[model samples]
Target: MVRPKEFDERVALTAAMQVFWEKGYEATSIGDLTERMQIARPSLYATFGGKKELFETALRAYVELSLTYVENKLRSMPSVKASFLAYFQGVIEGSGGSNPDFGCLCVNTMVELAPHEPVFAQITEEFEARLTELFRKSIEGGIQSGELPDQLNPSSIARVLTLTAIGLTVTMKMKPSPSRVEHVAAEILTLLE
Candidate 1:
């Protein structure tokens, strides 16, 4: 009987993600993935099927990691306003870290492949929907708690914030200046009040 794979799946995926995130889907070769993941070609295929499948897996992994942290900040923070701030602050900090300046995997993939790939388009749509829903909930909560304007339309405002955040993520890749991101974030938070 064949033994199960020995290496950590998450670690391999993370390594693969960093490569894909840095180079994008089309630019990333099988050789690059194997080199970055430090696994043999057969091991990679055995574990992740193939290049396309591995890219999808990496995208899903990135989404899960990123969304979990955002959700936690939104749920645990003392106030909706603070929660929004914390969420964006996390993005700024995460993007600025020593890791590749890949912006966001979801955003990068959406921009690069969504036009030509229906599956990626659907994934991008879901990502946006989830982010919009999170902001909508927070805005609704803020309104209930008297932190936001009574007239604020939660759905509309949430869409605006979601798009703004996506714009920021993409911008971070081109110009990863912390001060500029912080300035833009300040303006975004002001909308909540």
Candidate 2:
């Protein structure tokens, strides 16, 4: 007897994610989400519960989506070193549109809420850990395949890469450009090489 809802949930969620990315969790109002998502409050509540819940979903989605993007780039290149080079180059290139100034949502959230909120700290920590793990795996792969020197410590290198990414994301928000992002990425790759 009940009719199904009509709006595209994924699109709305992605929009909400963008809004949250631009404005931190605490600063984003219901009106902001409704406006950005093109949905009424009732529908938003029915689909995503509330602002907190929606923000959590957005954060998780951002992490998953970003990880997938990085993974694909790292896996597709001819060499592991090249994979990372392209990946970081892409970061500096920005999204190639408006909102280039919006940095990593997870990092922004960490800066805004992690100090006061344990939940955010956990999310931010997980985000960093995942990046570190991804870098570690890629470096390990390079070592196994003879693309990199065996004596190099993958863990330390990965930590450094992760830190570089964090720093790049932060810097991009202030002034995002291909030259800047590439410069940092290239310098970081120097360690890998």
Candidate 3:
């Protein structure tokens, strides 16, 4: 009879995700994953295939969780503008204003691995497209509700906002001055007007 696994896969995957989020794919070693995941190398291979596969799995989980967080934040306020402001503000503040900022896992992957790795490129690209769609829907709602000008182009504005978010997230990784970052975010929100 086959033996049952001793470790919890979800908990192990979460640990691996944290390791990857802290150290990019290249920088992370199998030893690092095994250690953080608290599983032996054989168990790692048996459970997750290998480092590349594990990274892919971890990244997909991060993508889903990130999108859910964004969707929930966007829907939190009745006013679309307020919702967006709060979303951007949450990004600026960095995980309830307590945790050390890692920027964003998807954006980090886009910068670190997407250009050379087709799989990562596709994953990150899909993430951006989804975020843009979310923004587009919210903007369309604003237009329908008469909160935004009818002539404004939702697609164009959504793309710009997505790019702005990407740029802001990358900038935040460098730990710039808080006031300057907030100023830049405020200026970006003016695009909604």
Candidate 4:
């Protein structure tokens, strides 16, 4: 009979995610995960299958954490445009300081492994689709509230904004200057107004 796991999965996953986020999937070793997770190798394998499986868990955790922020912006902000601006501002502000090497995990995975890994490609696509949907919904809300121009196409504009955000995220890895990043974000936000 299998025994119930004693360790906190969420805590372990958070540590694992941090390790994977700091180091790309290709570069993260099993030793790294085990060391970061503070678990035995046998226990890690038993609970999470293998390095790939653990990395997938970490990816899911990252998405969950990100979505929490997105959901908060969507539900609580006074206006759709304001919520989106806040969201992008958060992204710009968050991608700074000591960990500039690690950009958005989803974007990093797309650049590093999506071309060769079908599973990672699908995961990345899902993340992009969800982000697009969030922007599309915000655009639709803006139209309904008469905040955006009537003729504007929410779907296309959302795609553009999403792509622009992704570009900014990837670019942050190369250029950590807050002013430059904010400038690019300002241009993107101009489309909304």
Candidate 5:
């Protein structure tokens, strides 16, 4: 017979996500996960497998949450331009304008682990592709509605916006001037015109 889990897996995974988000995969230790997750070492292993597997699971959760947020934000405004603006502003003012406090977990993973780890590379790449598709779909809606120029290539513009977002997320890690980052975001939106 098997015993029931003492703690909520979702809650424990969220805690582990925060730990991995703050400290990259290499920097985070099993002790850090167990301590932050409030679980014993054996329980951590039994529940989440090894540290790498736990990180992968945590990353997937983050990606799902992030994609949902992006989709909702993109659809929140009727105007595609306004939607993009809101999205960029949200990035700049993340949950009280402290987004740079940790930077994006997926982007951070891309920089820290993707280069050396094929698994991470694939995960981050899939994230980027999915994000780009969301942007592309939003842009297509604008074109269809006659809000944006029909000649504009949604695919190309989406790629540019996605890359810009990734770059901005990485730059935010440097704690640069908020105004400057906002300026870059503004310039990116002009691609729609």
Candidate 6:
């Protein structure tokens, strides 16, 4: 019988995700993953199959956690407008924390690999669609609660927020200024009126 490896899978995957997020998919090498993961090639292959599989796994993990976070926060918050602003504030706080230019791991994968990879394109599209739905739900809740005007379109505002998120992610990677992002987010939230 074969014995399982001693390393922690969660730690390894998180480390690999960070590397991929920082350097991107095409730029991240097997050596880099192994180095960051603190595991040998055989162990990595045994655990995740290979680099592409590992990257896919990492992307899925990131998406799941991030989506859950967004969902939980938006759902629990009292004000729809405050929920969206808090979401952007989370983004700003995260961006300024560790690797300043880390941006978003899933967003990075989408921009770097989705164009040439159908699977990645689909995954990215689904992620964006779900995000849009979250925003739409919040907007709808706001309308029902008399917090927002009746004439406002939830679908349209949701799409706009989704688009703004993509742009903001890229901008963070380039500039990584929390204040600037926060200012832009505050301005964007004014549309809630």
RMSD of each: 2.2, 2.2, 1.5, 2.3, 1.5, 2.1
lDDT of 1 by residue, 1-193 (tens): 9988878888999999999988999999999999988888999999999998998888888877777766777887888888887777666666434242577889998899889988888888888899888889889988998988999999999999989888877776776655666676667898776
Q: lDDT of model 4 at residue 82?
A: 72
Give the poorly placed runs of model 5, Cα more than 4 Å off.
Answer: 96-98
Listed in order, each prediction's TM-score against the native is 0.89, 0.90, 0.95, 0.90, 0.95, 0.90
Candidate 5 residue pairs in backbone clash: 93-97
Ranking by lDDT: 5, 3, 6, 2, 1, 4
Candidate 4 lDDT by residue in tens digits, 1-193: 9888878988898889888889889899989988989988998998899998888878877876676667677666887767777777766766322244577888888899889989889888998889888889888888998988888888999899878878877877786666677665556778886
Global fold similarity of model 3 (TM-score): 0.95
Residue ranges of candidate 1 with Cα displaced over 4 Å: 95-100, 176-182
User: Taking the tens digit of each residue's C-alpha lDDT, what string does model 5 give over 11-128?
Assistant: 9999999999888888999999999999999999999999999999999999988988999999999799999988887776674223566888899999999999999899999999
Backbone collisions counted per model: 0, 0, 0, 0, 1, 0
Model 3 stretches astray by more than 4 angstroms? 96-100
State in Å the error of residue 122, model 2.
Answer: 1.4
Clashing pairs in 1: none
Better of 1 and 5 by TM-score: 5
What clash count does candidate 1 reach?
0
Candidate 2 residue pairs in clash (backbone atoms < 3 Å): none
Instruction: Report the Cα lDDT for residue 154, model 6.
Output: 96
